[model samples]
Target chain A: MRAFAHTPFGALSIAILRGFVRDRAALFFAVVFPLMFLVLFGALLSNQDQSEIDMITVGDVPLLEDLPADAREAFETTFEVEESDDLDAALAEVRDGDADVVVEQKGDTLVAHYTQTEQVKAAITQSTLKAYVDGANIAASGQPARFGFAAERVEDESLTTIQFFTPGLLGWAIATSAALGAAATLQGWRQTKLLRRLQLAPVSTGTVVGARVAVTIAIALGQTAIFLGLGAATLGLKLTGSWWMSIPLVVVGTLCFMAIGLLAGAIAKSTEGAVNMANFFVLPMAFLSGSFFPLDATPPWLQRVSDVLPLKHLNEGMLDVLVRGQGPSAALVPLTILAAFAVVVTLLAARLFRWDTA
Target chain B: MTAIAAKGLTKRYGDLTAVDALDLTVAAGEFVGVLGPNGAGKTTLLEMLEGLRKPDAGEVSVLGEPAWPRNRALQPRIGVQLQASAFFERLTAREQIHTFAALYRAPGSAADEWLERVGLVAKADTRVEDLSGGQAQRLSIACALVHDPELVFLDEPTAALDPQARRNLWDLLADINDSGRTVVLTTHHMDEAETLCDRVAIVDHGRLLQHDTPAALVAAHAGGGNLEDVFLALTGREYRA
Candidate 1:
């Protein structure tokens, strides 16, 4: 009798796994699709030049005048510098896409403001200005060549653009795959009356739901392995710090997204609507969460919004373990948030689930 | 012993009464049919009895066990083939039944036997979506019976089958009944109930008009005509269904 009870759950998981393996759409989203993203973003962001300057100077900016004659001539030739009297208007110009960079001098300190409109150009200006500042500092110090400090990266610091985005892209892919996979599968079962069929067996709704969640998490783990493997082999991704801790985070993150997907399935009346609804919530969350791109330079309000999203925590948690060289302690808060989100959303989904279609 | 006993079974969908104060009972090993047209609440009533839907006010017991609140104890004892159930996607017929058999912890050999019993051995390797409608229905029935439950419920099992396929299914159902496993089936086809059921329950407008053996029902209600004419006389309308 005990055997009778256990087999069904195992069978359900196996059956769901088989169905998922055969589902080309899910395979494309979870594996092939994310691989394409890893390649596309890796190539595009790595080759970008972070040196050309695009700046808007407001009021008296002494940094430009302090540059040596030869360096000032090279700086003036490489960048387009615009002068503005209204600091507020100059900042707005950067915000509104009318301009690329704004260098606001606050007494002795220099503040650079830029927009994501031309993210590549703005990034170049910020780094290039830092280089110019370092040069000026060295010249003023009057130090001999022997006394000058040489720079070296700390042992655990990230080495390249690919390393940072390896986790970022992995986060996005798993989020898409887990959320869309659960929603589509649930809605499809409802539409086809397979849910009703399962109800006839000697299994509780909790058992079926538990099995489904397990299978999704398993697939997500496989996805993480592939992303990490391919990222390291081809994209120069380095795994450091508490990187293995990402395994547990992957499981928890998958639960959170799968819960969201279940909510979409329960709310939408049709399969297509559920898929669209999952996408509607997940796509925006991906960008705000910094899955495809870093949100560090984004405005304060945008970062606050990112804080409210579960995907942000998933990405950020994995980033902490994988690249930031943080310990298991770093994952504690994000894991808690994700687990809590999973519980709340799953309850809501159960409340909204309709048996009529099933 | 009674296989099922349901009393005052009432289910309401807002303003509509899907099943209203219905009473029904099935003796062990008896083949009973619930005959009604589309929108006549046959499927709704069947679902309530199968424990898939909650009743507004009623009591239902399958194999002397409460069917509501989804009694897990009774689940293995009963098999249900829903009106529109689907197979696991992309699975071959053999794999589908094997999966269902595993759910019940039945041996894989039993799954194969059921495939042959349903005459799907030749098409066992075909993917479910590639099977014809009749083959799909037969595979569904085989999957339902793979565990050899004591009782079975089939809803509209032959609704859209061609004449030949329908005839073939009738034989399969007859075999199931001959093996002493009680069967409860709902259908709109008058002849289906009259020919295959030991007792037929005529229903309309969420009410049970009659329940008796076909010969007895005809003699007692219409005194002469076939089941359709008997339906026409009972409800004062042509039995289009």
Candidate 2:
């Protein structure tokens, strides 16, 4: 009976992990679901930067044909211009969503007809046409163009939207599923009196809770690796910083979420209640933390709210290493914040843990 | 030597006392039965003795160590089967027993041996959630005894079993006691107390009313009927609920 003192806790943890691994639903959440999102968001966003507006020109847009070399080249590159002798046919195509816009010249005025659903494409098409027309008008007036400019990409290599979203997606996967999984697992154990039964043994509650947390962190790491591997292989994800920097970041992120889950489980009356409470926290955090979009695009007040959130730090820290190529130093602040969160929530969970079902 | 000794064991929940200043003792190798009606504090008394619960004001020693308020060192020396045993949903019967065995650091029977002893060898690989109530009860016994502890506490172990299954379990308990290990159990069945217990303790309102052999109890209080008559005479004919 006095063999290895730590064997019981380790065994209990392994047994618990085995149960989760064998559950199909758990496996789907831990592995399959995140990969599905990676594939979807990767394919959808990777092509966004390279997309062009398909336009058909009607009437004599002499401004387009007489543009300066640079302006003409820019217009050609931004739009796939197709000359149409029949204006009615071109307008029909634009209305039916087959074409993005139709450019027409009426006397001295230029008109662009576009569909509202294709607002972004239509806006870009209108701006480019206006710039070309203004340049042509200045040239026709026999005056030097007030200013000439050419678009140039600042980065050495253009970045795909997939590269921008990969790290954030990885954070989202751990923050959403791992947190919910931990809460549900703890709540289920309590509901089924498994915790009560374990209390009968000589093992301390700390050992039991620690083992479960270790399993959660392991699963989180696995989720990160799978997402990164899938993103790199399929979505052309470029790793800027040392990938090893992501390991600690993932651990810190997992601890932060797991602690929140523990707190939720401690307060929940049942397994169902725990899941509901977890969703209440995870769903909003997934959005506000910049998991799916940039927090910079959000209002300044909302960004301030997101800055204090652990997931925001996690996503931004991950983006630093995976997207921006920032080194280990970039993750220091996030790790500290997450560690603080872990300690606080863990203490609260310990205080609230109940061995009895009641 | 006394396997269990309790002095002024009192436990209360809010305003209601579950186990009042009760005192009891059981010697080594004795088969003791604790009989009580619903809400009579039988489970509470047993739990207190097993160290699963703390007494409001009392001292309990089990297996030669203080048992109340928790004694980790004594946990491995005693086996406990709660009234409602719950296990991990995904673990099989054998796996569940192995889990407890690991926790106890058992040096005795292996998980398979315990499963065989409990007559569940054929169902060892079946998931716990798929097991019937009687099968789960039997599996709980296997888990409790897997460590081969010197003292075993069984609370309503055969409460949901059929007549044959109950008889089989009774024989198993008899065999366990015959091996010279102490066994303490609580039940509402008078026949179970008469047939299995060397001494029976009857309790009501968190107090011990009587403690004696079945034949002596019947003789003194049965009015020439049986142990059931003695129980009804003491606890009354009114339903506990």
Candidate 3:
């Protein structure tokens, strides 16, 4: 740590950090508020299940008459099971959309015919059936498996709801805090004439802004630690492949958001106005970017809009590394897009920036 | 040596001219006050001279260097005091001055001494927000002068203060002026200008009406009247400040 006893950048950064630390509202908004969202969303969505699939049994499906009663119960919860002696009737029911899938035991193999009208339901039905069979095969051989109540693929790992929300909500928190904090702080300084005082000093605008950015990045690191720590410790957030990769992703995200904030501050006429403007943009962007909801269930138009949102890319990048078990290369496109976003906004902010109030 | 020299200074926001083509000069070691009513462009003129706001058409040289485009070399050589609200968000009186001193890379020892000089030693740990109006104003002055600049600029340091508070600030300014650093202040308070300024520049409608010693300005304009009457004589109206 550079002591406050020397250097222009050090002094300015220390003062900014101290000011932020001392401000109760900022601390709550930046750190505590996000944690609350994590606990709320994490708990609410932790046990959320995929929609049940409808299935009809037409023949002696011995796999369904499983030796383990718990695995069978698990399948029942995921698929509404029905029995039919006639194949034509079962196939007609699936075709008529009464059932999503029709499973029949033909000689030695279990065959499943599913409807295409509801693609997601059909896909889940097929996968869940396969996982049950796979788990049964392993269980018969007497290998320890935790797939007692839930169908788990023997070879592949899947993302859970808690894992998904950790980064999504955390990303939302970082974006809002960095952007709002920058806008309010800058606009406040301008209103109070602190901006002019800084202009009079030997310090350059670059130094002042750079200090602010550095401090935000530091706080972002802390946010990541606390968010991830709480998520892991209490919410059962499993740290998967290259979870450390989120470090760089978060830094870039903070930069982009801070640039947006600086631009908002420069354009707004008052501190209160800047805060309103920041929230006006950040809140809707959070939902659109899939931070609060999953994008797969959204309309095509919403997905298309999210394609251009910076937070979307940030959330995608974080999901890729933190939960999807991706490597360092997974963050490349997001890094570039966010960096470009930051540069463009920084330039725009510079154009509108005034050392004194309008 | 001339501390500040400006020529053809002008600033305009759209069709409204805030500061007309104005020229002024101040010798090194003189306490000068720019006196005017509110919105008379005194702030615009001082900001342009301080290298904070760019003039639409003008040139400002401070401490023998171009102040426009911001003379980086001359930054530490001068100080600018802002309003009390400009202090860092929740800084104590001592921390505020220390931060400013550090920005200019001045000696840390000067920060504490300034708090004492401004009579804020007992309130050194008090956050600026909690300070009384006058104490906050004094702390603002201490922040500007923490680096011991050769020249200092203050923008309405005593506005909104009680009479006793205002007098305290005036006495503080007098102490700083006694140290022989060039001081330039902008104020609508006529008595403040007349009492503390060695020379007073009366401006109205963005034009300089008079710039002279307080005694000379009073003698040359109103004859038997004070500085307020001098403004009345210049504008044919009551001086609101």
lDDT for A15 (candidate 3): 84
Report the Cα lDDT for residue A94, model 2: 90
lDDT string for model 3 (A1-358, tens) is: 5464478898888888889999999899889998898898877877666667888899789888763776677777888889889999899888998888899887646799986798888788777778767866786789787544634553237667787788888899999999998999889999998988898899888898889999999999999999999889999888877888899999999999998898889889999998888877788999999888889999999999999999999999999998888988999899999999999998999899887777
Residues B1-241 of candidate 2: C-alpha lDDT, one tens digit per residue: 9999999999999998989999999999999999988999998898888887889898999878999667788888888887445687688887788878888776425777878888898898998888888889999988888888899998899899999889989999999999988999999889999999999999998999899999999999998998889888889978885
Tell me the DockQ of each model, to 2 decimals: 0.48, 0.53, 0.65
Question: Which candidate number would show the highest TM-score if scored against the true structure?
Answer: 2
lDDT of 3 at B227: 89
Candidates 1 and 2, the one with greater lDDT: 1
Off by over 4 Å in 3: A1-5, A48-156, B238-241
- Off-target runs (Cα >4 Å) in candidate 1 are A1-6, A48-159, B236-241
lDDT of each: 0.85, 0.83, 0.87
In the range B1-241, model 1's lDDT, one tens digit per residue, is 9998999998888898978899999999999999876667788898888888888998999999989989888888888898434788888899889888887778888999999988899999998888988889988999889999999999889977889989989999999999999999988788988989999888777888888999987887776788877777776664544
Give the higher-TM-score candidate: 1 or 3: 3
The 10-residue segment with the lowest total lDDT in model 1 chain A:
A150-159
What tens-digit string does per-residue lDDT give for candidate 3 at B74-118?
999998887888878888888888889988998778988988888
Clashing pairs for predicted structure model 1, backbone only: none
